[model samples]
Target: MSKKNLQARDISWLSFNARVLQEANDPTVPLKQRIRFLGIHSNNLDEFFRVRVATLRRMIELGGKKGNMHLEDNPQAILDQIQMTVLQQQNEFNRIWEDILKQLNKEKVYLTNEQNLNKEQQEFVKNFFDESVRANIIPLLIESLPQLPYLRDKSIYLGVVMRKTASAYDQKYSLIEIPSKVVGRFVQLPSPPGEHHIILLEDVIRFNLPYIFSYFGYDHFDAHIFKVTKDAEIDIDNDVSTSFVQKIEKGLKNRRKGKPVRFLYDKEMDAGLLEYLIRRLNLSRRDNIIPGGRIHNFRHFMDFPDVFKAQKKERVPFTHPDLQKAQRVTEVILQKDVMLHLPYHSFGSVIDLLREAAMDPDVTTIKITAYRLAPASRVINALINAARNGKEVVVMLELRARFDEENNLEWKEVLEEEGVKVLIGVANLKVHAKLCVIKKKQGTRIIQYGFVSTGNLNEKTARVYADHCLLTSNRSVMADINRIFKYLENPKTTIQHLRNCNTLLVCPNAMRKRLIAMIDREIKTAKTKKTAKIYIKLNSLSDELLINKLYEAATAGVELNIIVRSIFCPKTDQRRFKQPIHAVSIIDEYLEHARVLIFHNGGKEKMYISSADWMVRNLDHRIEAAVPILQPAIQKELKDIINIQLADNVKARWLDDELSNNYVISGDEKKIRSQIETYQYLYQKTGKHSEASSH
Candidate 1:
C-alpha cells in the first residue's frame, strides 16, 4: 500500500471508536451493554484527545521539526479531521442516548433532569443534596475572581448564570464543579412501585441551586454541564538532582496545570458563560471547542445504575482444566505450561501461584513487571505477602502508566514499606511487558517458574479484557525474563542483559528487526509459490516500517489475516496485490486486547503472545516482550481462538480502505460472534457441560 493511501493513525482510531458507537446503536445488544459501550466510546475519545490530539497539537507547534517524526499528514490537517470526526461521533452519541432513553422509559425507568422532576423527586433531591452533596461542593463566583478558577480535567463543571427573575441584566457568572467523584454521577430517587427514577448528580445540584446560592438571593438560574479535557503529557524535567519518583510526582502535579486541548460544553449553555469560559480558558476554535448535548462527562455513565429489569447473566469463569486438579498452581506450571484464556478461565490461579510461592519454604525470590494494576490488586497482595514471608520480591512498577500514575506511586510506597524492592523502571523507557519469575531452591538447584501475558496483571480488568497468559517453567523464557529485570535493576550498566535475550523477543533491541525478518521470509516463500501465510492479532497496528513490509508481503502474494481492535493504519486494498488482506476489527462486551502473531514457517508454525502492539512507541520506545508458544498444544489452542475470531460474522467490522466499518456478513453461514464462540470452544474443552453463552 502507498504511504499516501495509509490511513492517519488518529483518523483510524476515530473509526475504531465509531465501531464502538455502532455497538451502542445495535438493538440486538443488551440495553445495559449498549449504554456501557457509549461509556467506553466516551472514555476512549477522552484519552485520544488527552494523548493523540495533544501530541498533534505539539507537533503543529514544532512546525518543520514534525518532519522528523515521519507523519503521513500535516498535524493541523489531522487535527481538523479529528475535530470533524469527533463532532460527528458526538451527534451520533446524542442520537443513541435519546433512543436509549426511550427504551428505558418503556421499561419504566426514567432519567429525569431537575426541571423534569416530580414533587416527590424534588424532595428526594433536596434531601440527598443536604445529606450527601452539601459538604463536597465548592461553588465558585467567577465574576468576583481576578481570573477564572482552575477547572480540573476529567471533571464536569456546571456553568451557571444566576440572575433575579425581574432583572436579567443583574447576573453573576458562577462555576460549580460537580462533586460526582465523591457522591457519584447517578443518584437513584424514590419512584412508584416497580418503577425506577434516576437523576444525574449535576441535576441534583441544579435542583438545590436556590439553597446553594440563597445568600445572593438569586430567583433564577441557568446551569449547564461542561467538561475540559487537558493535555495529559507529563513533562519530566532533566533535573538530575531529583529522583525518578520525585520527577513523576512533580510531573503529575504539573499535569493538573496542563493546557486545555478540548473544551466540551452543552450547546444550550448560556452564551455569555460559554464566551467567558472560552476566553478565560484561552482556547481557540482550533483547540477542539466542541458544542455537545446536556451531558458532558458520559464516562460516569459506565457506572450507570443497574435499574433495568433485564439483568445481565454473568458468565462465571471456571478453573483452567490443567489447574483444576492440581494441589498447587506452582506444581502444574512447573510440570507443564498452561495457557489461561482470561474471563473464560479464572485469574485466581495466577494469584494462587504467587501465594504458593510466597508460603513455600523452598521459594526464595519473586520478580514481576507491572504496567497497570487493579484498584484492589490480588497480584499486589500476593507479592506483598511474599515480601513479608521473607522472600525477595522485586516489582518493576511503571509509574508512567498514563492515568494510573498516582495509583502506581501510592503502590510504590506501600511495596517499599512492606520490604518489597520496588524498581521504578529505567529512565526514558516505560516497562510495558507483563512478566513474572519465581525461583525456588530445590535441594541447592534453583528452579524457576512464572507467567508471561499479553495484558496487565490486573485481576479486575482480567475479567473484562480478552487476554492470554502462559504459565511456564521454561528455562530459556525464565532466563530472558530475569535478564529483563536485571536491565530494569540497573538500566545504564546492565544494558547487555537486555541485548542477550534469546527465547523471548525483546523490543527496542530485536523484536522489530526480527519481525521484519519474519515478514521478509514469508515474502521469499510466496515468491517460490509455496504456502506462505501470517495471522496477526493486535489492539493496534500503525508502525510505518512494519506496515510497509506487510504491504510488500501482500504484493508478493503472501496471505495475511489481521484482527486489529483499534488504530489500524494499513490499507488492505492494493491493485498490485495478488490477494487482498483479510482484516477485521472486533468490538463487543469484552475488550479485545491480546496481541498474537502467527507465522506459517514451512508448516512449522511460529506463534507468540505479546504485550506490545505494532505501534512505533511499543516497538521502539517502551520495554516489551513476546514469548514463543513452544508447546504444540498451546500453539494450536491459540490458533483455534484466532481462527474463531477470523470466522466471526457478528461483532466484526471489515477494515476496508474507506474505513466504512461495515459488519462482516456471512452469507448462508453460521452467525458466529467471536467472543461468545471462543468462550464456548474453550469451555467445551474443559470436559464440563457447557452453559448457554451470554453477552
Candidate 2:
C-alpha cells in the first residue's frame, strides 16, 4: 500500500495483457482461440496507450508533481517502463504470430498474400477488389494535397509510393485508407475442398494498385500497411454557458483531432515515404513510432473466418434452475432470492423479468440504471414499452461511461421522447450501480421488487462476461433501492437521503467506511488468534488506502484469499505475516467480472455481491452498490462458485511480487477448468442445456 509496494496501474495492466499473450502462445489452446487471444491482446494494448499512457504524457507536459494525475508517485518513470515493456511484448507477439502461422500452414489454412495467389485466386481477388473495394476507396495523392488527410482512429491505411522505372521525376506518393470498416477485413478466396485460402483486405487492394492509378500510368508500385493511435480521453470544458450535452458533442468532434500518441508502420516501409509521413503528421522518433510486421490492424483478426473445423463449440448459457420452469420471473423472485450467474445462465431470464413487468397490469413503476447498452438493446425496448403501458419509468443513464458516451447520449433522447424520465446522474460521480426497481400494486399497496447486478444490463455482454445478478424482493433491499433513486432524482436535495441505505453499502456515502470497519474486525480477530478469514473477488484492486487496510489485516495473521482479474497492486512477499496471502488472477474465455466480499465474522459468514471494484474511482468517485445475500442457499452457491475459481489450476495465475504471471499448477488433484466445471455444475442443478425449457 505504500509507494514502494504499489505497482503502477499502467504497468500492471500491461502485465495483465502479457497473460493474454500467453494464451496465444500456449500450444494446448485451439488455433482459432489462440488467434483470438492475439487480437484481444492487441486491442487491450491500443486502449491502454490511448487512455492511460496518453494521460501520463499530458501529465509530464504539465509538470508531473506528486499527488497529481491520479496520485501516482511518478508519471515519467511509468511511461518509460511502458515503452520498454511494450517493445518486449511486441517482439513476443511477433514470435507468437510466426508460430501460429506455421500451425495454420500445417492445417492447410494459408493466409495468402497478393504475390502468393494462385491463378484462380488472383482473378478472384482482382474482381472482388474492383467490385467491392474500389468504389469505397478514394486514393488521395499525397503530393497534390497541401496537408495530409485527417487520419481516423481505429483505421488502417496503405501508404503507397508509385513511380516509373526510367523517370525518377515521375514518382509520386499517394495514401489509401484500407476500407476494412466498409468491406470485411478477411476475404475468403476460392479454394479446393480441404484447403482454405484467405487474404487480408489490404493485400487484395495491393494486388490491384496499378489499376486504381491507371490514369497516372505508373509502372512500379509499393504499398505498406500503417496505422496510428490518438489520445481518446475527451476533455469537457467547464464553460457555464454551454449545456453538458453540447460539451459532450463538441468533445467528441475534437476527439478525432486528438494528439497522436502512437504511429505504427510496417518495418519494411520505404524510408522516403516513412519520413514524409512522420514530417506531415508532426511525429518524431521520440513518439511511439513502432515498427511492426506487415499487418497493422490485426485487431480485425478477432472476427477471422471460422474456416478451420472447430474442435469445440462455444458455450451456451442455460436457464437458471429457479426460472427454467417459472412462467414469471417476478413470481420466483417474490418467493425467494435467486442468484443468476451470467454466461452460464440464460440472460433471457433478465430480459424476461423486464418484459413480464412491462406487460403486467399490476406493475406500477420501474426504475433502472443504464451504464452500457447493446447495439439493439432489448432492455431499452422493455423500458420504453413500460412507459407506453402507463407505468412510470425512470432511467438513470450514465452519460459518462467511457467510450459509450455517444451511444448513451443517443439513448437519452429516445427515452425522453418516449416519456421515460432519464436522469444523467449527479456531477463528478458516474452512476455505475446496476440496479432495477419494479413496483406492482396488489390489492391496496404497491410492493417493490427487482434485481441488482454486477454487470451491465446489455444482453450482448451477458453472453460473454461472467457476472452475478441477484433477483430479490427483499423489502429492505427494495427500500434502499428506492432511497438511492430518490437521491439521484434530485441531487440538489440534501446528501442525507443517501445515508438511509442501511441494507446496502452505497459508495461515496457508506461503502468505504463500512468496508474498513469490516476489515478492522478481521484484524482484531486475527490478533486474538481466533479464526479470521476474508475472501475477495473483484475486477481490480488499486485503492491505496483500502489495500493498505488489507495489508494491515495480513500483518495480523489473517487468512486472506483474493481473486482479482486485473490491476492488482498488493505485494504478497512479507515474511512477517503469519500466513501467505493468496493473490491470484484468473483469465479465461469468459471475463471474470463479478465482485464479492465475504468476511468470516467469528463463525457466521457475511456475503455480498457488489458492483464496485476496490479502486479509487469506484469507492471515491462513483455511485456503486453492495447488497448482502441473506438466502442461505444462494450464499452457499456463491461460495461454491468462488471456491471453484480459487481451486483453479489451469487459468489462474499467482500474482507474485515480480508480476510474473505464473500459472497455479496442481500436481495430482483433478483438473478443474472452472468455466467448464461451472457449466457442468449448473447443468446438473438445472438439467439445463440438455433440453429446452417450457417457458
Candidate 3:
C-alpha cells in the first residue's frame, strides 16, 4: 500500500486504545477488571498526548521546516482529527464510568464525593482530612501570586472558587495540589456491615475546604479537578563537556518545564475559574482542552479497592514442564532449550537462573541489558549479589527508556555502588533487546548460557504482560549475544562485531534487510505456485518498507496470518491481492506483548522470537535482536499458541480496512479465548489438570 493509502499510525493507535475502552464497556468482563480497563485507557491516552500529540504540535511549530520526517498528512489536519476522535471517546468513557458507578451502587459500594456524604461520613471525612491530608496540601491563592506555580504533569489540582456567604459577586480563586502521590488517591471510609464507602483523596480535602481557608472566613467553596499533560520529549543537548549521565539529568529537569499540550477538567468546573486557569497556563483553543466528568485522573482507578462481592479467581503461574523436575533452572536450560510463555509459565525461573549464576563457583561473568525493570527488581538484586560474589557483572541499563529515565538513573547509582559495572547504552540508540549471557568454567572450558526475552525484566508486569523468553545454551545464539554486548561495551571500535552476527537478526545492521529478503523468498515461492505462507505477531506493525514487501507477497498469493495487538498500518484488504490477509487483534486480561515471525520458506518452516517490532524506530534506529527458535518442540509450542490466538472468537477483533475493531466471527466454530486456551495448552504439557485450565 502507498503512504496515502496506509493508515496513519497515530490514528491507528487511537483505534487500538478504543479497543481498551471496549473492554471497559464489555459486560462479560469482571467488574473490577472493567474498572482497571478504564484506568488502562486513561493511562494510555496520557502517554499518547504527552508523546505523539506533543510531537505533532512540534511539527506544526516547525511550519515549512518540517525536516525529513515522513508524515502521512498535514500535522494540523491530523491534530484536528485527533481532537474529534478524542472528544468522542471522552463521551463514551463518561458513559462507561457512569454505568460502572451504578453497578457499584447496586453492590452497596459507594464512591462518595464531598456533596453526597452522610452525617457520619462527613464527620469521618473531616477527621481524616485534618489528620492525614491537611499537612500535605498547600493552597495557592493564585489571585495574589505574581505568577502561577508550575502546574505539575500527571498530577490533578483542585481549582477552588471561594466566596463570602452574603456577597455573591465577591470571590477569590485558589489552587490546591491534590497530594495523591504522597497520600494515595483512594481512601476507604468506615461503613456499616455489608456496605462499603470509599472517598477520593481530593474529596477528603474538598470536604474540609472551609477549615483549609477558615482564616479568610470563606463560607462557600467550589472545587473541581483539572490536569495538565506536558510534552514529555526530552531534549538532550550536544555538549562535549557534559557527561551522558549529566545530559540525561539535565534533560529530565527540563521535562518538568515542558509546554502544555493538553488541559483536561471536570465539565462542571466554575466557568470563570476554568477560563482564568487556562489563560494563566497559556493554553489556547487549538490545544487539547478537553472537558469530562467529575473524575480527571482515572488512571489511579487501575488500583481501585478490592471490595467487590464476587472475587476473581486469580491464575497461578506454573513451572515449565522441562524445569519442573530440575533442581536448578540453570541446569535444565543448559541441557536443552526452554521457552517461557510469561503469565502462563512462572517468571521465577528467569530470576532463579540469575540467582544461581550469582552463587555458582564456576561462574565468572554475567552480562545483561535492562530497559525497564521492576520497582523492587529481583533481577537487579541478583546481579548485585553476583558482583559481591566476585563475579564480573556488566549491566547495560538504558537510561532513556522513555518514562523510566529517572528510575534508571537512580538504579545506575545503586548498581555502581554495589561494584557492578553499569553501561548506559550506545549514544542515539536505545538498547531495546532483552539479552543476557553467563560464562561458567567447566574443566577449563567455558560454557555460556542465558536468555533473550520479548519483555522487560520486571516481576510486577510479568503477571499481566504476555511475553516470551527463551532460555538456551545454543552456542551460536550465545555468541551473537556476546558480540552484541561487545558492541555495546565500545560501539566506536566494535561496530563490525555487531555486523558479524550470523545466527540472530540484529537491527540497525541486519534485521530489516533480512526480513525483507525473507519476504522476497516467499514471494518467489508463491509465484512458482508453491505453498508459501507467513505468520506474524507483534505489538505494532507500521514500518513502510516491510508493509510494501508484505503487499508484494500478498499480490504473489502468499498466505499471511497477522496478529497485531496495536498500531497496525497495512491495508490488508486490497483488491489486487490473491486473498486478504487473515489479520486479527486480541485484547484481553493479559497484554499481548510477544513478537514472533514465521515463514513457510517452501515448507521448511522458520521461526523467531524478537524484541523488536516492525516500526521504523525499532528496525533502523534501536539496537534489537531476533533469535531463531531452533528447538523443534519449542517451535511447535509457539506455533500452537499462535494458532490458538488466530482461532480466538471471544476476545479477538478483526482489523478490517475501515479500522473498525469488530469482534471476530465464530460462526459454527466452538468458542476459544486465546489466553485461557494458551494456559490449558501449556498446563496440559505437564500431564496435569486444574480448575483454572478448564476456566
Candidate 4:
C-alpha cells in the first residue's frame, strides 16, 4: 500500500467523532438525546488526547522524524489539524446546544444563567450555594502562592480577577477548581408554578462571587470558566522487583502531573486573563488552545436530570427476552449453545451462568481472564463465591487496563483475599482476552463449558454497550482455553499441550496468521468466480499490515464491507484499492462495541467473536483471542445483527472518501434505528414479552 492508500489513524478517529457530532446536529433526534451525543463526543475527544495523542507525543520523543516518516503528516502537523477541526466542531456544538436550549424552553424548561435569575430563583441559588457549594470551594490566591497548584486533567476551573476600587492598579488573580464532581453540575431552582428552571454550577458560583471573595477586600470581580486536557498516558518504570500492581498505582499518580495537551477557555474571557493563564501554565500557542462556551464539561449531560415526566424521555428499557428469567442458564448451555446480544439481550445470563457454576457440586474449576471490570462487579463476586465453595478459581487479572488499573488492582486484592488464585497478567504483554471456562461433571464425563465475548464482562457497561457473547460446551474449544490458561500461568510452557482446536482462533501466536490465511482463502475463492464476501465490525481498523492485506483481498474481487465505530485509516478511493469498501459508522443510543468478522468460506460462512481489534497492539503486543462461531444458529444470529446494523439508515453515517460524516438516508422510506430495532428483534425472537389484548 502507498501513502495515498492510508489515512492517519488519529485523523480517522476524529472523522468518526465527527459522525457523533453529526448525530448532535441532526434535528430528527430528540432534544435531550442530542445533548447527550454532544457529551459523548466531548468525552471521546478527552480520551483521545489523554491516551492516543499522548502515545503519539511519546513516539515523537523516542523515534523523532524517522518514526513519523510513515505518517502522512508529522505529529505536530496532525495536532494542528486536530485543533482546527475541534474548534470548528466546538462552534457547531454551541449552535446545537443553543438550539436545544430553545427547544427545552418551549417545553417549559428554562436554562438560566446567573444574570438572568429572578428574585425567587436568586433565593434558591443562594441557599443551594450556601448549603452545598461553599464547603467544596477552595480558592487559591494566585499571586500570594509560592508554587502553582497542579491542575487536574479534564477538570474545569474558574479564573478570578479581583480588582480593588480603592486603587486602580491594585488587582489580584486567583483560581478556583469547580467542585462539579462533588455537588452536581446542574442545580435545579424553584420555578413559577408550571415551569421548570435550572442553572449551571459555574453560573451559581458566578452568582455569588462577592460571598466567596468578601475577605479579599475587592470591590470588583470577574471570572471565566477554563479547562485543560492533559496527556493521561501512564509510563511505568521497568523495575523487575516492583509488582505490576504497584507499578500501575505509581503510574496513576504520575498521570496527574502529565503535560497539558489542550487548553480551553470561555470565548468571552478577558484577553489579558487568557494571556496570563497561557504564560503561567507555559502553554504554547500550538497546544490546542480552544475557546468554548461557559460550560466546559458537557459530559455531565450524560447524567442529565430526569426532572420531566416519564414520557418525556425515550421509552422504557426492555429486558432481553432470552435471559430475562433464565432458570437454568448453565443447564441450557450444557444442552445447547446460547448467544447473548447485550443491551438488546440482558447480561444477566452471563452472571446466572457463573452463579450456577459456583453452586454446582459437579463443577470443579472456573477460570477467566479479565481486562476491565465494573466498579461493583457481580462477576468478581461470583468468582469469589466459586472459590469459597471449594472450586478451583483462577483469574488472570490484567493490571494494565488503562484508566481502570486502580479498580482492577483493588479487585485483585479482594479476589486474592478470598482465596482465588489471581495471575497479574503475563510479562510484557497485557492479556486482553475475555474468556471464561468452567469444568463440570455430567453423567460419566467432565465437560468444559466456555464463553467468549467481544466486550468486557462488566454489567454496568453491558446495559448500554452493544456486544456479543457466545456460550458453548464444545470440547475442542474448551481444551484450547485450558491451554491458554496454562500458558498464561507460566509463559515458558509450551502451547503444545492442547492443539486440537479446530473450532477457535487464539491470538499472539496464531490469530494474525490465521486471519491473513482466511483472507487469502477468500481471495482464492474470489478468483475462482465463487461467492466471496468479507464483513467486519470492529471498534477500530488501523494496523497497516492487515489493512494492506485487506486491500489486496478487495482487489482480488472479495466483497468487503466494514462497520467501524471509531477509527478507520484505509482510504476508500478507487486508485488505492480495486473496489471501494462499503463502510459506515453507527453512533446511536447504544455504543456499537462488538468485534465480529464474517467471511464467505465458499458457500458456508465463517463468523467469529473477537476480543481483539485489528490494531497493532492487539495483534502483536497483547494476548488476544478471536473464537470462531461454530454453531450454525449462533452464526446466523451474528450475521443477522451485522445485517441489521448495516441496514441502519437513521443513525448510521457513511465514511466517505473525504471522511465527511454524511448521514445515510434512504429518502422517505421506513426508518431503521438499529439499536431499537435489534432490541425488538431479540424480544420477539425470545418471546420475552406478551402482546397487549385488542381494546
Q: Considering every candidate listed, which one attains the maximal lDDT?
A: 3
Clashes of each: 0, 0, 0, 0
Tens-digit lDDT track for model 4 on 328-411? 887677777788888766787888889999999999999998988988899999999999999999999998887788888889
Q: Write the per-residue lDDT of candidate 3 for residues 1-695, one digit (tens) a residue.
A: 45675888899999999999999999888888999999999999999999999989888787757554455458888899999999999999999999999998999989988888889989888888888889898999998988889989989999999999899988999999999989999999889899999999998888899889999988999999999999999998989999999999999999999999999999999999999998899989999999988888899999999999755456789999999999999988889999999989999999999999999999999999999999999999999999999999999999999999999999999999999999997887889999999999999699999999999999999999999999999999999999999999999886899899999999999999899999999999999999999999999999988999999999999999999999999989988999998999999999999999999988789999999999988988899999999989889999999999999999999988898899998798899999999998898899998567322
- CA lDDT, every model vs. true structure: 0.91, 0.90, 0.93, 0.83
Q: What lDDT score is found at residue 421 in candidate 1?
A: 96
Error of 3 at 348 (Å): 0.2
For each candidate in turn, the TM-score is 0.98, 0.97, 0.99, 0.94
lDDT of 3: 0.93
Clashing residue pairs in candidate 3 are none
lDDT of 2 by residue, 1-695 (tens): 46887778888888899999998999988888899989999998888878988898888877756432475667888888888899999999999999999999999999989999889999999899879999999999988889999999899999999999889888899899888988999999999989999999999999999889998889999899899899998888889999878888888889899999999999999899999999999997768889999987778888889988756456688888888788789999889999999988999999999999999999999999999999999999999999999999999999889889999999999999999999987878889999999999999998889999999999998988999999999999999999999999988877777898999999888999999999999999999999999999999998989888888989998899999988988888777677778999988888899999999999798999999999888998999999999999988899998899899999899998899999999999988778777777777897534442210
- Writing each residue's lDDT as its tens digit, candidate 1 over 393-446 gives 999999999999999999999999999999897776789999999999998699
**Distance from true position, residue 506, model 4, in Å?**
2.0
Stretches of candidate 2 above 4 Å error?
65-68, 312-314, 687-695
Better of 2 and 3 by lDDT: 3
**Model 1 lDDT vs. the true structure?**
0.91
Which structure is stronger by TM-score: 2 or 3? Answer: 3
RMSD (Cα, Å) for all candidates, in order, is: 1.3, 2.4, 1.2, 2.8
**Which residue pairs overlap in candidate 1's backbone?**
none
